[model samples]
Target chain A: MNKYIQDTHAHVLIWLEEAANMIRESFTEQLIIETKSNFSDLVTNMDKSVQNFFIQKIMEYYPTHQILGEESAEQFKDTNREHVWVIDPIDGTANFVKQQDHFCILISYYENDIGKLGYIYDVMNKNLYYAIENAGVFLNNSKLPTPPAISLQEGLVSIDVRNWYGKASLERLATEAFDIRYFGCGGIDSIHVITGKFAAFAASIAGPWDIAAQRIFAKELGLCVSKFDGSDVNYLKGGNWVISNKAAYEDLLTIVKEF
Target chain B: MNKYIQDTHAHVLIWLEEAANMIRESFTEQLIIETKSNFSDLVTNMDKSVQNFFIQKIMEYYPTHQILGEESAEQFKDTNREHVWVIDPIDGTANFVKQQDHFCILISYYENDIGKLGYIYDVMNKNLYYAIENAGVFLNNSKLPTPPAISLQEGLVSIDVRNWYGKASLERLATEAFDIRYFGCGGIDSIHVITGKFAAFAASIAGPWDIAAQRIFAKELGLCVSKFDGSDVNYLKGGNWVISNKAAYEDLLTIVKEF
Candidate 1:
């Protein structure tokens, strides 16, 4: 890896640790929460604060880098920027507000629209899963081997079963797969796929910040990340996507794509 | 608690710790698995061994107690027995074989067909949630307070989304509730209800041993346990049951009873 990317990774590790502590501290006090988009979609004061922390650090150290974040006010439209950072301060805000677990912080770095470094920090579990471009994926600094291929019938799958046009697809997947589970968090579900515990994770709708980090990890870990129709998932534009093991991707997509 | 019950609970606690250690040790060796009713209904060798261990202990100590177990060869039919025990060595056998995290051990003691004591041991997480008749529920020896009432729209509910006659009912619950989650384990889901982490847990199908322990926990915690049609759940004939908060019970049953 390049020196600049290596140094940025070091900074991110330190920042995530500090941010985790902030989240832990917030648990002791009452949280200020508001709904977004719908009743189930939630955002807490901590989400905004954490996003601002990342934006400030990125701007201070890499002044020229563009930023796109879940809680950012201004839209980041300059696609031609050489360096861009994407962040979801809290990937599972509802889980964070309700369970105080099964949530994570997501951050990714892109150079010329190409993925570089991606991080998914499960704050409560204290597990940091990150991937480097052309290098490898690591969980808590331990290199992870490519997970063994598993079929939908041989392994479990986590899915989002909300009302959607693809309800039939999800039902079919649920019936055909060994079983279905949902932690109500995309990042945690994706981690199950990364660790070979789940065959796949499919969601009907998501934002760029939600699926960004998993894309990098999927590439490095030899997993498949694509839209429900088996199209290449654009990191900048996430709609509906599935991250899955190679053995189960085709079968899972067959059902998931029936929308 | 009666003197006999208290003495019995003490012995059960010690036996559970030993069983947990045995399970942890079994993880190091390869598991021998077999299917029961279907491909998804699994029984590992450990399940049988654990059930046998409990059977041996009960016969040696009580000598006259009627025993019903998941892996037992002969059916236990003497319902008039003054003392009876129901045991599911591993509540989530599929999870035990797959994830090894969400599964647990379920045991219940009944006197004259009334629940006297129940134990649900999450062997991996090491959380032992148990309830005693006329007393209170406890988690790892710490007494647990009654969970606050929460409506269907106010709290999450876990469901078994497998193919069944009540598929539409489940879909309705998933839509009307705040959200849905599943650990694919009934005991773990019941534990969530006991701790107020979830408003309810409903399974479309289950066996006697599956729902016995939860009945005891529900009574002590002031939660509602019933059939899908708002009828009393039979501890011996576990078909379809829901253990839910009083606030959510009616609304959940209104949807779940459509079958």
Candidate 2:
């Protein structure tokens, strides 16, 4: 690891801890919430505040670095850059507003187009899952081995429940996978895949911020991250994506692609 | 509360804590796993061991009590008894085998055909939700207020993911509720509705032990517990069931009952 990257990792951890504290404190205070795109798609006051916090820190240190965030303060056009940061301050805002838990914060750093550092902070659970390219993934200082290859028949999968309502996605997985579960939060649900607890996660719709951190971390752990059709993911242009164990990826793609 | 009932509550809580410890210990060791009715329906060695432990304690402490357990060694048929206990040592066996979390221990006690005391212990989360007949429902030591009546359009719901493999149950809720989620564990999913986090839970298939504890606890919290067909639940006979909040029940029934 480069000296600069090492220092940056420490700084990011410090910032994440501070962000987690802000979320905890927000729970005791009243939040201002509004919907985006649709009723189920929600954003809370903390989402905007947290996103602003990250942008402020990034601008102060790496002033010219490109950034793509959920609540972007100053939008930067997609470009090949030496340093780029992707952030989703609150990945599952609906869970944050209704359940007050299960949501997570996602942060990823790409240096010269290579995914260098990725962090998925499960705030309520106090879990920090991160990956540093080939250096391997860690769940809060504990090194997590690349998960074993699991097949659809023997594994459980998490699917965005709303996507299953149309019958096609639900029926395809119902016959192949052992069962399905929904945590309704991308970062939290994807952690199950990272730890080998679940074989895959298929979300029909998502934004760049939603799948950005997951893509970077999944690459380090030997997990497959691709569009629903098994094509390479364009991190800057997120759509339907499937993150799965090596063996389970093909099975998930076959089903999720149909939707 | 009578002296006998109060003492029984204390004894039950004490035994539950011990059972939780036993579960934690088993997770550190290899558990013998086997299928029950089919491939997805599983029963671990710990499930049987836990059930046996509870039965033994109950028999020794209250020999005259009639009991119905998932893994019953001594058959105690349904009889007119002053005390009857229903136990599902490990409610979500598939989850216990796969995720090692989300599973729970369920126990319900009835006196002379009337539900008296009920306990749903989420073993992994260490949340013990209980109800004492007319007494208020509680999670750990904190009393939970009766959840407000939430309408279908404004509430979240849970459905056994397997149940949605077919289009009937899926579309019934897809168009009505705000959204849907699946935890793959009945006890864990019901906890969401118990706390007003979710409006309802609909499972197409379940056994007596799967819902006995929820039935007792839901009654006290003023939540509706019934069959999917809007008929009364036969707690001793395994069948489909719906447990919902007061206002959400009618809307759910209007759709679910059709299936």
Candidate 1 lDDT, B100-219, residue by residue in tens: 788999999999889999999999989998999999999899999999888898788888865532367756776799888888999998888888878899898989898988999998
Worst lDDT 10-window in candidate 1 chain A: A161-170
Please report the candidate that would top DockQ against the real structure: 2
Q: How far off is residue A18 in model 2, in Å?
A: 0.9
DockQ by candidate, in order: 0.51, 0.71
> Which residue pairs of candidate 2 clash?
none
lDDT tens digits, residue span A102-215, model 2? 899999898877888999999998989988877889999999988888888888999887766765778878878989988989999999999988999988888877787888
The native-contact fraction of candidate 1 is 0.43
lDDT scores for all predictions?
0.88, 0.86
lDDT tens string, model 1, A1-259?
A: 9999999999999999989899989999999999888888899999999999999999999988889899983668765659989899999887787678889999999998788999999999899999999999999999998989899998898877554312676667766888888888899999989988889998888898989889999999899999999899888878999999999999998988886
Q: List the residue pairs that clash in candidate 1.
A: none
Candidate 1 clash total? 0
